[model samples]
Target: MKFKSNILILVLLAVFIVCSVQSVSAANSHNFTTDDNFDTKFADVVNGDTFTFKAGSYNLTSDYLINKKVNLVAENEVIINSGDYRFNFASESNGSSVKGFVFLGDSNNPKATTPIATTGPTEDITINNNTFKYVYDGVSFGRYATNNFEFTNNIIDGFLRDALNLGGGSGHGDVYIVNNIIKNNLSAKDGIAIAYKGSGNLTINNNTISNVIEAISINSFNAPDLNATVIIKNNIFDNVETVIEDPNHSEIIDSYNVFNNSGESSLTHTPKEPANIIINSTISKSSISKDGSVNYTVKITNSGNRTADNITLTITLPNSLKYVKTISKTTGDYKNNEWTITALDAGSSATLSLTLNAKSTGKQTIKSSSSYLNGNETTPKEGQTTTILSVNKLSTKITVVVAKSAILGSTSKFKITVKDKNGKVLANKNIKVKVNSKIYTGKTNSNGIATVNAKISNKGKYNVKISFAGTSDYSASSKSVQHKVTASDLKIAGVKRIGKNYIVKVKNIGDISSKSTKVAISFKTDNKPGVIQYATVKVKALKPGKTVSVLVKFYINKIYSSHKRNVIIEESKTFKEASYENNIISIRK
Candidate 1:
C-alpha cells in the first residue's frame, strides 16, 4: 500500500508540472526592437502568440516566412524595408493578422517583386492599416484558392501591375475589399487596382481608385458554371482607362458607383446621376371625433441637381384607423398603401392625398417614406399624428303642455314633446311623466309627442313633470308645468217612480259649480233575475250645494212580475263625481 501511494504521488506531481509548462507556452508573448534580428525573432514564435515590435526601420536580409497563426503588431512609424524579396505567408499562417506597418519596396526593382504575397491557401487573413509604397504588387495571392480575406483601410501607391490580386483556383470564398485608397502617379497602361480571376462573391464597396489603367477586372476563365457575383457600389473612380473589365461576362451588380470621366473611350457603365430626395407630410385635421375622417397628404420633392427615377412611396397607418378611398393626387395612383412614380424632374415636387377613417378613439400616427433604385437612395421617415375624440351626445329639450285648470276627479291630458337643440323632432324616445305620486311611462310617437292621462284628485295647484332619457346621440332633459285643479263633483240624491216614469235628483257635493251631464238609472226585477231595465236623464247645471231633478221613463217587462225592484245611478263623461257609492238607491213596488 505504501509503494502504491508513492507511485500515485509521483504521477500527480508529474501532471502538475506538465500543466504548468503547457500554460506558459500557450500564453507566450514577445516584444522586440530594431536591435533584434527579424528572422530569428519570427522563428521563435509559435501558433496563437502575439509579437509587438517597437518603432524602427528593419531591412530584411532575405524572404521571411510566416508559418504560424500569430498576430504581428507594430507601433506607429515602423517601416520594413523589403529590398527585392517578399514576406511569404504559408498555409500554416492561417488566421493571422498584420497591422500598423509601413512597407517600403525596392524602387529599382519595382516591376520584378511584390512586398507581401501568399505562397499557399491562406484563409481568415487580415492586413489592415498598412501603407505600401513603391512596390510592384501589394498583397498578391498567386494561383491559390483562398477565402475570407479582409484587406481594409490601406493606402497603396506606385504599384506596377496590381494593388490587390487573387486568382488561379476553382473555388474562392467571399472577399470584402472596403475603405481602401489605391492610386498611382505613373500612367502605366497595364496597372489594375483589383483583379480577381477565381469564382466566388466579391464585394468592392466604399473604395476610391484613381489614376490606374483599370479600376476592377473580374475574369472567370470563361466558365459559366462558377456563378460568381461581383457587387461594386459606393466606389469613386477618376482618370482611369476603364472603370470595370469583365472579360468572362460574370454577374456584376453595380450601383451608386461614381465614375468621374464619363466620356472616356473605354468606359463600361453609365455614370450615376447625383440626386437627393426630400419628403414632407401633413394632415387635414389633427383632432377629430369618432367615425370622422381626415385627409393625409404627402409631398415628395427632388431637391437634387439631377432627375430621380423609379421613386416608390409607402404609407403606414396605425391600427386605430381604417383606410378609406383616396381623394386626389397630382402624380401616381395609390394601391395597397404604396405609390410609385416613374420619374420626377429636378427641383420638382408631387403630392398625394388619402382619406382615412377613425375606427376607435386614441392617439394615432401615420408614417411615410420614399425609396429609389432598390434602396440605394432613400428619404427619411416622415410622420404625422391625428387624435380621435369621443363624441358627446346632443342636447335635448322636453316640452310638456297641459290644461291650466281641471275639475276634480277628472283625467288631465298632458302633451309631452321632445326635440333636439336645433328644433328637430326625435321619435321613438322613452318618456316618463310623474303627476304627484303617480308615474306613467311611454314612448313618443312619430311626431315626437306622447299623451299621458292622470287623475287630478286634489283641489289645489300641482305640477306635471315630463322627463326624457338620452340615447347614444341625444342628451337627457326634463320639464314641469303648473296645473290648477278645481272642485266639481256630482252625486245622485233621490229617485221617485210614477207609473212608468221615474224622477231622479242630482246634487253638487263639491265647492264649485258642476257642468251639464247625464245620469243613468238601471232597474232589476226579482222574477227574472238576469233582466235589467235602464233610463237616462239629463241634468242642466248645479251650483255648490244645489239640487236638480229630471224624469226618466223606463217601461216594465210584462213577464217579470215581482214586488221588489232595484234602481242604480251612474254619472256620464260630462262631469266628474266625488263618490259613486251613494248614486244607487233601492225602491219597492
Candidate 2:
C-alpha cells in the first residue's frame, strides 16, 4: 500500500507541472484577451482615457480623431486591417500615442475608398512604436498643427505610399522624424521618404529609410509667402532608389536640408551634374538705411560634387536695389558692383560681401533670395530692414486711425501696428508713444502702439507729432500727422520781427483765438547754456487780433556775438527738437 501511494504522488506532480506550462504559454500568446470586438472599444474610449484590444485583426472603418490624450495599446502582432490614418490625435492630444500594433492602410474603407474631406484647426500629435505595412500615405500632418513629435522604434515593413508627408498647411507642422526603419515604400507617385512643404526646422536624425523614389524633398507652394526656417542635420538614407532627386531649393530661409549621413555612404551619394550660372547668390542683410546705405554679406559656394569650370561668380544684383557685390574668391571691381571668382572645386566654399545703397531713409526693405544653375532658388518678400540713421525706427510708423468724434479734452483708443513690407512684425520692445505729453505714454504694452489722452489747449488748430526714440539695436525716426482739435475753421497766423531789434510783434489775423501762444525760434549754437531767449509778448488787438510787430525782436550781447560763430537756429525756448524742421529758421548773418 505504501508503494502505491508513492506512485500516485509522482503522477500528480507531473500533472501540476503540465498545467503551469500551459497557462504560461497562453499568457505569452496574448498580452490582453477580450471577448468583445475592437470597434466597440475604439468607439468607447473617451479622451484622456484608456482602451484595450484583444489579440486579433481589427477591421478599421473610417479615420478616427482622438480629441483627448489617451493610450491606445495593443497586443503584439495585432493588425489594424486598414492604416489610412486610421487614428488621429490633434491639438494638445499630442500626448496621445499608439503602441504595440501593426497598421495596414492599404485596404479600402468599407464606407468609401476615398477619404472624406473636413477642414478646421487641429492640434499637435505624436505617433510611435507602430508597424506600417502596405499603406499609401503612411501618415501626414494637417495644416495649423506643429509636428515637433517623433517616430521611433517602429518597424515599417513596406510603404505602399508616401512614407512621411511632412507638410499640411500654413500651420507650424515642422517635425523631428527620427529613428524609424522604412523598408519598401514602392509607390512611384511620391516615393519620398520625407517631404517638406513650407514646413520648417525639421531635425531628421538617425532614421533608416530605403526603397523610395526620392530620399528627401523641400518643396514650397509659393516662395514669396513662406515664413519658416529649416535645418536638416545628421540623418541616414541607405539604398534608396534615385528615380527623382531633390534639388533642395524649397525653403524661404533654407531651401532644403539633407542631413549628413553617419559616414554610411561609399563617400559618394550622387554625382553632381555639370551646372552653369552667371549670377547666383543669397544676401544675409535685410534692407538699406533711409540714406540708402546697407552693409551686408552674401555667400557663394558650390553645392555640386564636381568642380565648377571658370567659376566666374557674378551676383547679378536685383537691378532694383543696385548692390556692389564682393567675395574673397572674387576678381572683378567692387566699385562696378560685380565679383568674379576663380573656379570652386566641388564641395568648396566662397564668400561674397556687398554694400547695398538704400534710396530713401524711412524703413527700407528688400527680398533675400538666390538662384543657382541647378534650378535652386530661395526667395522671401519683405525680407530685411535697413535703417538710415534714426534710432526709433518702429514707433515712427504711425497709422493714425481716426474716428469722427475725437474732440478736445476727449480720449480715443486705437491699435498702433508696425510691420515691414513683407508683413513681418518688427520687434520693438523699447518704443513709447505719448500724446499731449509724457503723462500719457504707451511704453509698457506693445511695440509702436501709443494710447493717447487728448487735452487740446487754445484749440484753433492742434497737431499730433509722433516721435520715435531709438533703441540700441536701431535708429530713431519721427513723423508728423495732422489732426484738428476744433470743429471750426482754424488758421495759423504769424508776426514779423520788430525791424531786427530787441522787440517782436504778434498777430492773429485769421480767426478769434486764445491770447496766449507758444512762440519758438532756432539758434545755430548747439550749446545748452540757455541760448533760447524766452519772454512773454502781449499784444492788444489792433483789429481782428493784431499786435504791434516793433517789439518782437531779441538781441544778444556784443561781447558774446563777437566770439560766437555759426550761431544759427538750433531750437527756441518753447520748442522741442522733435518739433523743429530744417526750413523753420533763417540765418541773419
Candidate 3:
C-alpha cells in the first residue's frame, strides 16, 4: 500500500510539473484586440514576451515603451495614430523588434520628437517594414552606444527632421539600413535622409532617397577620437541638394550609386585639417589661333591659416595640345602632361605660368587642380579655363569649267581646279561643286583637277560654284561659273550607195552640239567565203539637228554578186549621250 501510494504521488507530481511548464510557456505571449490603451497592458507583460497586435487603429496619447527584450508584432495592418505621443525603446530593449506597424504622428505638435525614439543603449533592435508618415523625426536613437541595430525595408516619409538619425553619442556598431524609401523632409538644416554621428561602422545599401536637403550627412561633432567607417553602396539619389555631406575624420566608402542631378556632386566631403592651401588658375588668352600658343597662370596662395607642406599642382592639358614649357618664378617639374609644384609656405603665393602650343584647331579646356601632402586638412582647389582656337585659313582659289552649253539629260563634264594664292595647283584637295544648289564633292587628283559627270534634266542657265574646303595648311575659297543646258541626241540616219561609194549619214536629232564623235562603217561581201572590211572616221563637232555624211569606198571581191555594208555612229563612253540604239543603220546592194 505504501509503494502504490508513492507511485500515485509521483504520477500526480509529474502531471503537475508538466502543467506548470505549460503555463509558464503560455504566459510569454500577450494578444490584445480591443481599442483599449496598451500602456498598462504592455507594462503588465513580462520581459521576453511576444506582444501581438491585431488589425486596427490605436490612438495613443502617450509614448509606448518597449522596455524589455520583447517582440511587438502586428498581425495585420495596424495603424498607431499618436496624439503628442511616440514609441520609445529602453536600454533593456535589446533583441526586441517593432515591425509591420504604421506610425502616424500628430502634426499639431511642431516639436522635434521622433515617431520612434530609442531612450537608452539598445542593441540588436530590428525595426522593419514600418511606415512613419508626417512625423517630426522618423527614428531618433539618442547618443547611446547601440550595436547590431538594423532598420530595413521601411518607408519613412514627410519627416521634418532626419528621416533616420542614428546620432546620439558615439561607439555605435554595425547598423544595417537597407531598402528604404525616404522622401520630402522639411528640415533644411538637419533634415538628412540618413545621418550618422556615431563612431562605429554603418552599412546603408539599396535605399532610394529623394527631395531632401541632404541625402546622407556624417558629422561627428568634431570628435577626433571618433572615427566612423560608413559604407554606402547601391543607393539611388534624385533631386537632393547633396548626396553625401561628410565632414572631416570620417572614412566613407561609396560606390554603385545612381545620382540624377547633373549639376551637383554625388558625394561631397571636407577633410578636417589645421592648414589648407588655395589654388587659383587663369589663362592669358581665351582665344588663340591654331598656329599660336596660350599661356596658363596658376597661383597657389596660403590663406594665412596654416603652412601647406609638399603642395603638388597638377595641370591636365586638352587633347592634341602639346605642353611647351613652364614659366614660373619658382622651379617646377612638368612631366607627362602634369605640372607639380613642390611646396608652398603659409601667407605666400606661388605663381606659375605654362605655355601650351595648339597642335590642332577647335575649343580646348585646360583644368588645373592642387593637392597638399603630409596630411593636410583643407579641400583640394581646382580651376578651369577654356581657349577657343581658330583654324589656320590659307588663301586659295577654285576654277571651274563647264562647256558654254551642255546637252540636257546628257552627261556634262565639270572640271574643278584648286590653286593657292601664288597660282600653284593644290594636289589631293577636297573640292565641292554646287550646281544650282546640288552639291558634288570629290578630291582633286595629282593635276589639281576634280572631274565630275552630271546630267541636267531641265534646260536652263545654271550657276556652278566650286569650293575648296581648306586644310590646316590652306584657306577655303570658292568661284562661280555659268552654263546653259540644251537637249541633244545623235543618230545615224541611213547609208546610201552613190555611184559605187557608200555614204553614211550621221545626224544630231536634238538641240545642243555633239563634240568629238566617231562614225564606223563596215562593208562585207555577200558571197561564200565572205570578205569583211571596216572604216572609222572622226567628226570634230556636229551641230544640233544637223546631218553630216561620210563616204566609204570598198573594193568587193570580184567573184561576189553583192555587198552588205553596216554603218554605226559610235558613242563616247566618257561623254553621256541621249540614245545609242538609233546610232546604227544597215545597207545592202
True-structure RMSD, every candidate: 19.6, 28.5, 15.6
Writing each residue's lDDT as its tens digit, candidate 3 over 1-589 gives 9999999999999999998987763348878675656777786766689879999988777778877788878888998886577778888778888889988876655354466788887788899989888887788885666678899999987888778877546656688999999988766675778877777788998999988888887764434356678888778888888777666557777665778762275454323333456667777777665656778777777674556665666777767578788676465676665656666566778777878787666666666666665333234544343334443434678877878887666677888888876677889988777778678778889888899777676767888777887987677888878887775567878777776667777888767777667777665544544657566777657788788888766554344345666676764444545666787777775
**Taking the tens digit of each residue's C-alpha lDDT, what string does model 1 give over 462-551?**
877789978756778999889888876676778787887778787887778877767665655556667776567767878899998888
lDDT (Cα, 0-100) at 151 in candidate 3: 90
Model 2 residue 172 lDDT? 60
Those runs of model 2 whose alpha carbons end farther than 4 Å from true positions after fitting are: 1-34, 42-44, 83-85, 90-92, 105-121, 142-144, 221-224, 241-589
Model 3 TM-score, all chains together = 0.42
Tens digit of per-residue lDDT, candidate 2, span 1-589 = 9999999999999999998877652211112344554455455444566555567876655666566567667855677776333565556465566677877655433222111111333434456777776665566553433455556667666564456655546646556666777767655565666655544566555666666656665553323244455444334555565422334433322212232322222223333343333223434445433334455554555655555544333333343355643334343234444344445565666655666654333433333333333423222111122222221232224455544344433554434454443344445433344445533344423454545554444334444555556554335555555555432211223334444343333344333332233333333333544564333344343334454443433455321231222212222322212122331333342
Cα shift from native, residue 222, model 2 (Å): 8.3
Best candidate according to TM-score: 1
Q: Give the TM-score of candidate 2.
A: 0.34
Which rank order by TM-score, best down to worst?
1, 3, 2
Give the per-residue Cα lDDT of candidate 1 at 129.
90
Collision count for each candidate, in order: 0, 38, 6
Q: Decide which is better by TM-score, 1 or 2.
A: 1
